[model samples]
Target: MTKEENLEKMRHSTSHVMAEAVQSLFTGVRFGIGPAIEDGFYYDFELARPLTPEDLPAIENKIREIVDADYPFIREEVDKEEARQLFADQPYKLELIDEFPDNRVTIYKQGSFADLCRGPHVASTSEIKAFKLTHIAGAYWRGDERSPMLQRIYGVAFDSEAELEGYLARQAEAMKRDHRKLGKELDIFSIHEEIGPGLVCWHPRGALIRQIIEDFWKAEHIKRGYDIVYTPHIAKLALWKTSGHWDFYRDYLYSPIEVEGQEYILRPMNCLGHILIYNSQLRSYRDLPLRYAELGTVYRYERTGVLHGMARVRGFTQDDAHIFCRPDQIEAEVAGVLKLAQLMMSTFGFNDYELLLSTRPERYVGSIQMWDEATDSLATVLEKLELPYDLDPGEGVFYGPKIDIKLRDALGHAWQGPTIQVDFNLPERFDVCYIGDDGAEHPVVMIHRTVLGSMERFVACLTEHYGGVFPVWLSPLQVVIIPIADRHVDYAQQIKNELEEEAIRSRVDERAERMSWKIREAQLQKIPYMLIVGDKEVESSNVSLRLRSGEDVGMRSLLQVKSLIKAVIEARAQTALEGESI
Candidate 1:
């Protein structure tokens, strides 16, 4: 077998050993499916009680014993009746057996522990090595909420111990770069039980960063011929019903609010509002490709288990836009949006990304012909742009086929960055039409897109990508003035006033602390530059510069320093003092 194939079998076999250990330790522990997933393995069980981290070491010890025994994994085929009797006590396994229509069933046995499974495991328990159980979490059986919640044990196994060590080291770095930890330490954003889970309250620093992003997004959209628009957060429920969101996305929709005997709901999307605007006026082919953009906030009822910091939130603003164009203009409109997406993503220092062309799903609203045409248009744009992409079958939404781009950061983490979808269903459903030169009404093609996705998720990606050391343009406090002593306070304040007039975010460290302490505090805050003012520097009309990385940049005139900082900010450079030794 190839190396990857062997590793897969080893991981699978390790999961069986884990199951055997669990069965011996816990009496009446019903088992669920255990599968080798990407980078690791997981097994679900309805145990007598909750499993904890403290329980993992004991399980690992039992697994070691099983491995030391060198038990061969034996595959056996049995009659359906025999399989039923074998797993009669294990209802989860029996449920699997009942789903198969065949007369025979296959089972894999390692030592005395037999499980109903299809065979593709290592030869024996001894073949498994370099395995460690990581952590535990609750999972619903088959991912159905109505089903019983099961305790899931997760573990990692590699072909060698060295590989395992490397993976764990990378995981440690990932933990250090975790957005939730940095968000708290930097006072970026916070979630409270009173405000509910999956909802974020942006602090001053985070909001300032968000404002900078918003300003850039709006400016770019306007430059691309998009007219900014706004829509209410809550609308009458009947509107969603007409847009097909009520029938299709009801699960993610919140409960209705009754205002004066009318049912209203928090909008889960901004498409319907844009559609309403398109229908408000009589359009013409001459107005083809009318682009409307909005930084609209919407709400979704996300499960509590899935919420993490700003990455996944209940209320977030999407940098959403819709294009109403004729069928002939589809390619040009898509190309324009894709170009804009590329610019926005690259400006944020994301150069590594993957594109996916997602085709129609099983349950869809548009006719197959329209779906084919829309898919072809997106593919044609990709070809024209000389961009390669992978095909994801049956993953598109019920309304359209989309191009999804995932951005990879320096840490090799992928973030959902940009997307463009061609929708024919909404236009047809809403009867959104434009009068053509033939003097007749025809359905206008609708394009939905977001270059940077939601504000919350984008900020989370930025936080992790740079490890909270944001670029000069995106930094909340660009420069901090640190006065050496009480005598330098006035001069420092004057410098701060000058920088503020230059539109550079600056602050004065007025605390009665040592200059070193103040400079250390600024560095801890990840401020881009620390300007030190003392008697000598004040007398010379200069400031000592210190980088957050703790480099002394020597003393320089405030005029020259401000010019360098302003140039970096204006160019949206990825790093401050680009090409400088510091």
Candidate 2:
């Protein structure tokens, strides 16, 4: 076999070894399915007792024993009736056998165990060299919630010990960068059990950071000739029906509530609201390219097992906007939005992104010509920008084609953040129009775009990217004043007041704790700068500025410090403005 084919066979064989190990440890543990994933493999089992971390070692040891035995994996073809009878005790396996209309079926056997799987396993168990079970979780049988629950053991295996060691080290490093832990450690945000899952409660510090981000977004949108707007969170169900969301997306949305005789729903998107705003007024070609921006909050129904911190949540706020333009202007508008998305992402220190342009799906709503036009607009923009992107056939939304941008995180993990989509269905449904150059009414083209796709996911990405050490301009507490002694309190308070007056967030550590303890607290909070006020510095009417790293920059005048911070903020703003133009 070729090297690549051998690796696939080895991965498949490892699954059998894991299954044998599970059967040895847990008697009467019925198996579901074992399959290879991107990096490794996993097996699901319906065990009598819940499996924990302590059970992994015993199971792994059994797998090692099986490997030492060097059991040969033999494949054989069997008739459908014979296969069904052989796997009668295993209902799930029997069901698999029943699904095959053909009489012939492939089965693999090792030692005393046999599985009804298509055979492409390694020659023997000894070839499975390095492996480790990663985690334990509950998975529904066949991914159906109404089905039986199974205990899933997720693990990764490699051909060599060196590869396994490297994988483990990378996993450890990623755990350190997990955003949920960092968010709590930095006191940025929290999700209380009492408040329910998939919902976030932004604390005081986190709220401040969110506000700063929103303000910057508003400023940039205004400069780009985009109008900011807001709408109600709950709307009549008839509005969604008119927009087709009630039919296509009702399952992912919360159940409606009755208000008098009308049913209302908490919106899962802001598109309908923006469409209403457009329908509110008649327009001409002169009013084309009308861009509306909103940091609109939305709620969606998420399965319980899928919720993971801020990345996957039921409630989130999107930095969303919709642009209404003429068909001829679609290319320029799409290019502009792409430039805007790149700017917003790069401003947050994301330089590398994976771009995907998805085409029409099988069940798409628009005409072939409309789909072709929408796809061409995005493609043309990418060509003009000289950007390398992947084209995915039959992967777009039912309404239109889209461009998805996934930002690479610190650990080389990709997070989907930005997206730009074209829509033809909404215009037709809403009957929106504009006066063309010929003075004839024509349907307008609409583009939906979001830079930070969802605020909750964006914050999670930022938390992991910075490792809780946010940049100066984005830091919740930009500076903290730590007075070394009671005598320095007056000067420290005065400096803090001045900074506050200048709209630079500053706080005085007026606690009875020692200066060292106070500084440590500030560091723990990840404050960007710590200003120390001692008697000598107070006498000189200057403050000693200490960075988060503990390096002191002597002493500088109050105005000088203010000017320095102002310059830093201005530089960031300039870079941000440049990034938006891209």
Candidate 3:
């Protein structure tokens, strides 16, 4: 078997052993589904009482004992009636069985525990060589809020000890770089119970960073021949129905509102609005490929359990754009979007990423000929660009085929970055057309794309990627001036004024705190530069500079420092000084 398949088998079998150990310790505990996740596995249990951290070691010890026994995993195929009798006490299992339409069922048994599962586990418990129980959390059965909450025990298994150790080390680093923890410490953003879950309130610092990102996005789009536009956050519900979103995407949409006896909905996507703008006037073939861009805010209903800090939220602004082009212009427009996406990602220090081509799905719209043509166009772009991509068959959106870009961060973790899709369904449904050379009206092809995905999630990814030590170009507070004593406060203000005149985001720390304390605070805030003003520096008309890395650069003239910062900002450098000493 392949290495990945083997690892999955080992992890799944370890979870079975873990369940056996739990049943041995806690009698009469009902089981829930346990499946292998990205790097680990988790099993849910309905125990009589809540499990604590103290209980983990005992469970781990029991699991080790079971592993030592070298129990073989036996699989059996039974009829529905037999399976029902075997798991009569497990209401969850019975519910799962009832949902299946077939009479045949599969079960896996190891030691004294058995579960109704369709699994390809390892041959025996001894194959689970390296394993560790990580932590516990409360998960609702079947992920539904109305169901009973269960205790989830998470664990990871690997083929070798070294691999497990490396994974553990990365996990430790990830904890330190957790965006939620850093967000609170840096006072960037917050979510309160009163304000509702999945809704973020950006503090001053976070808002400033967002503004900078938005400004950069708009400027780049304008430079690339895109017309920036604004659209309302709500529109008539009939619009969604005509666009087919109400039929396919209604689950994520909020409840409708009655305005003047007509139903309106909070916008869940910006594509429909862009299409409406294209349909506002008749167009000729010369006016084809009109690119419309918007940093539009959208709302979607997400379950509370799945809501994360800013990575997953109910409301967010999408760096969205759509192009309405003729059939012959489809390939060029898609290639142009690919280039723009690459530029944006590389600017953010993401040099390594993966691209995927998703083909037509089972429930796709438009004719077979149209779907084939659109899919061929997307594939041709990837081929012509010589970009390597994976083919995900039957995974495209209902309306079109798409190219998905995933960016890898410093920790070797991947996150969704950009998406480019060629759509024929929307134009057909909305009756968007342009006059062809033959003096006949033909349907316009729509291409929807986004470079940053969403503002909130992108910022969250950036926070963890850089560990909150943003480069000078993107740092909300680029520089902080620290005064040695009350006597030097005037000099520090003068330095701040000079930096501000150059359009640098600088701050003067005029607090009644010691110079060392102020410097430490600035360092903790992860500012790019700290300018120290003292009696000696003021006498010489210079300021001592210290980088966030604690590298001390000797005193330099005020203009020299300003010149250094401006150069970095103008170049949009991704690092503070590029390891240069002033």
Candidate with best TM-score:
1
Name model 2 segments beyond 4 Å from true.
1-11, 26-32, 46-50, 72-124, 140-150, 158-173, 192-196, 407-415, 539-542, 550-564, 573-582
Question: What pairs collide in candidate 2?
Answer: 339-582, 343-579
**Candidate ordering by TM-score (highest first):** 1, 3, 2
Report the C-alpha lDDT of model 1 over 224-243, residue by residue, as the tens digit.
Answer: 89999998899999988988
Q: Name model 1 segments beyond 4 Å from true.
A: 72-91, 94-109, 116-120, 159-162, 407-416, 579-582
Give a tens-digit lDDT track for model 3, residues 369-456. Answer: 9888888889999999999999989999998999999865444566677899888788888899999989999999888899988889
What local lDDT does model 1 show for residue 110? 96
Top model number, lDDT? 1
* Candidate 2 structure quality by residue, lDDT tens digits, 408-476: 555666777889999999999998889888989899898888987888888888878777777778888
Q: What TM-score against the true fold does each predicted structure earn? A: 0.91, 0.86, 0.86
Question: Candidate 3 vs. truth: CA RMSD?
Answer: 4.1
C-alpha lDDT of residue 398 in model 2: 91
- Global Cα lDDT for candidate 3: 0.89
Model 2, CA-based lDDT: 0.85
